[model samples]
Target: MTLIVDQSTINIQVLFMVNKETKKALIEKGAEIIYLKGFNNTGINEILEAASVPKGSFYYYFKNKEDFGIQLIDHFLVRFLSGADRRLSVTKSSYIERLRVFFDDFLEFFKGNGFKGGCPIANFSLEMSDLNENIRKRLDTAFDQMNNKIALFLEGAVKNGELPEDLDTGLVSNFILNSWEGALLRIKLTRDVYPMKLFYNFVFQDLLNFN
Candidate 1:
């Protein structure tokens, strides 16, 4: 098969791909640093340096740091929801087991990291919500997106008798997210797994009450 290649089309394709790769690189590098440091403590130049990107071209990809932060939240939301969907969708598993698998993944992650770098969204919320409205709003929506996903799963569990029929999925999911984020904060502060384990225990045994 003879391939007819247009030079202009090829150039556009290459440029678009490069742009996407560069943007993803920046977000990934930035997320790495911001996870350890914070939104206020982290600088764009630092992210650029980590990404091995030139100084001037950041504006080419993002309008500003706020733009970058918003993009980061958006990127995180997509990745998080994807993982949640996977962890919460095992066909043969009980709904409770599916949720336990989800938390266990994070439990292992924080333990491996020595209990540092808690939830990225919670970190951003603590640092940026009072400071930047755009970023705050983006973070707000991200939390809601997360809650909605968990609630959707919980709603299914309620319908299937895995949870009580009277259970409020929305409220329960909101509480679970809040408590889990708080647990992450505690573990990060104390550098201990006790709080994380505590959350896992109470959530499953007391609140959800699943056998």
Candidate 2:
């Protein structure tokens, strides 16, 4: 006996994969809007409209708006950390030079974005830190991971004699991240790149100078 499978069943399976892709696209679009507009200011309809995704699709993928926000935070951090890791891993540059290049690259990126949205982690922390515990935890984890990466690079700099042997890598890492976040906020407020330039000059030229 021969058995036949229904074509409709195969189509349903394909549709399932398509749905998953669509859901992820919506989440990414939501992340973009969140960066441009704060969590409280963004509405579901607005996200759906910007994403060009149906309301049913959003509901199918996420449990609610808050769940979408959580996923968005995770998504941004993954991209952010990956980019930083790649930039920091460049072999041709010293650790100090790598750090300067990374800062310059981001300064250009913020300027390209018109200085409208600050750092995503900083944006969420300012808006959701007190309001949402889950998001707060997510931001905390992002900070720890990014700070650790910076410290690891700083330690390498010390070993390479690019930085002082007695330099406190961990402390310097925290200060750098904190200062960058603060500079981003000021840049967004002033709609000027001066704050970023100041930060780069101070951190790279003054604070981290070993020569």
TM per candidate comes to: 0.95, 0.89
Expressed as tens digits, the lDDT of each residue in 1-211 for candidate 2 is: 8899899999999999998888888888788888888898999888898888876667878898888888888888887777778877898989988877777777888899999888887889999999989889988988998898888779989999899999999999999999999999999889998888889889988998887
Compose the digit string of candidate 1's lDDT tens values, residues 1-211. 9999999999999999999999999999999999899877999899999999999889999998899999998877887799889977787887777888888888888899999998898889999999999998889889999999888778878877899887888999999999999999999889998887888889898999854
Off by over 4 Å in 2: 1-13
Error of 2 at 55 (Å): 1.7
Off by over 4 Å in 1: 1-3
TM-score for predicted model 2 compared with the true structure: 0.89
Least well predicted 10-residue stretch by lDDT in candidate 1: 87-96
- Top lDDT prediction, candidate number: 1
> Candidate 1 at residue 111, lDDT?
92
Instruction: State residue 21's C-alpha deviation in candidate 2, in Å.
Output: 1.2
Top candidate, metric TM-score? 1
